[model samples]
Target: MGLKWTDSLEIALDLIEEHPDVDPKQLHFPQLMQWVIALERFDDDPKHCGERILEAIQLCWMDEAD
Candidate 1:
């Protein structure tokens, strides 16, 4: 199944894979949201996203990064 807004960890993993050099902690929410939407397997309405969701994804990404 394609990824939804709730799939924060999966999305974080994918983001790291797709942009290995990026620092997840430094990403702005708008850019992060765009990148998430650009993920090949992502499948969700952009309207479903919010600051909290973005923060969750960022936290997951940071955890994976560390």
Candidate 2:
């Protein structure tokens, strides 16, 4: 019911596909992980429909070389 690492990757891939302007090189992994954690937390909160977490969430794009 929440976003795991795999889920986050899927979301990230979709976002990268949608936004041509997005640069994967500029992403920071630490910040991205924190956001993912927050997203999962929001999903578990019954009172919150996870709207706040959904607002402007960014996922990092990982290259195969890395």
Candidate 3:
């Protein structure tokens, strides 16, 4: 199975690799969602996304960057 929405660390790692120049702190949810969907390993339902999940992804991404 592909990565799910709950795979925050994996997703964050992917985001970090894909967007090396992007600062997660400046990222907005819509763009973040789009980016996540664009990931080759991502296969989660779009409707499952929410503010809390996005926040978790953002936090994980930030941690990965640091």
Candidate 4:
């Protein structure tokens, strides 16, 4: 099965690998959502996403970036 919204670290790792040049701090929420949905391993419903989940993903991404 594909990754879910709860798979924050996995998603973050994928995002880091896919967007190595992107600054997580500068990523807009809408763009972040788009990127997340675009991930090949991501399969959760878009409607299931929310600010909190986005924030968690963003934070995880930032952590991975460092």
Candidate 5:
């Protein structure tokens, strides 16, 4: 299952708060950048941050359905 939207948003914000140097907008273009984005996007929504990152990574995967 996909992560809750609030969870995603929280992670994104945490990356922003902790690093304070990484740019969030650049994340959509690169794999590493995307990881950073995911971290920032789900850093404060409960305690499933790790799960949120995994879900985000899977979202980029190309499946047989596609």
Candidate 6:
């Protein structure tokens, strides 16, 4: 199975690898969603993403960044 909307940690890890220089703390949901959708392993419906899911992804990314 590929990455889904619920795969916050996995997505975050991919984001860290894909955008090592990006500051997750400064990203907006739209941009975050866009990047997630563009990830190589991402395989979810963009329409399924919501504010809470995006927040979770961002938080995971920030946590891993530290």
Is candidate 2 or 5 superior in TM-score?
2
Off by over 4 Å in 4: none
The lDDT, on a scale of 0 to 1, for candidate 3 is: 0.95
The positional error of residue 64 in candidate 3, measured at the CA in angstroms, is 0.9
For candidate 1, report its TM-score.
0.98
Writing each residue's lDDT as its tens digit, candidate 4 over 1-66 gives 999999999999999999999999999999999999999999999999999999999999998788
CA RMSD of each candidate after superposition: 0.4, 8.6, 0.5, 0.5, 9.8, 0.5
Candidate scoring better on lDDT of 2 and 4: 4
Show the colliding residue pairs in model 5: 8-41, 10-43, 11-40, 11-41, 11-42, 11-43, 12-40, 12-41, 12-42, 13-40
Clash number by candidate, in order = 0, 0, 0, 0, 10, 0
- The total number of steric clashes, by the backbone 3 Å criterion, in model 4 comes to 0
lDDT minimum window of 10 residues, candidate 5: 57-66
Stretches of candidate 1 exceeding 4 Å from the true structure:
none
Give model 6's TM-score versus the native structure.
Answer: 0.98
Per-residue lDDT of 10-59 in model 3, one digit per residue for the tens?
Answer: 99999998999999999999999999999999999999999999999999
The sequence of per-residue lDDT tens digits that candidate 1 reaches over residues 1-66 is 899999999999999999999998789999999999999999999999999999999999999999
Residue clash pairs of candidate 1: none
Please provide, for model 2 over 1-66, each residue's C-alpha lDDT reduced to its tens digit, 9 standing for 90 to 100. 554443445556555555546565564545544444454232333333243333334423444113
Best by lDDT: 6
Runs in model 3 lying further than 4 Å from the true structure? none
Worst 10 residues of 3 by lDDT: 57-66
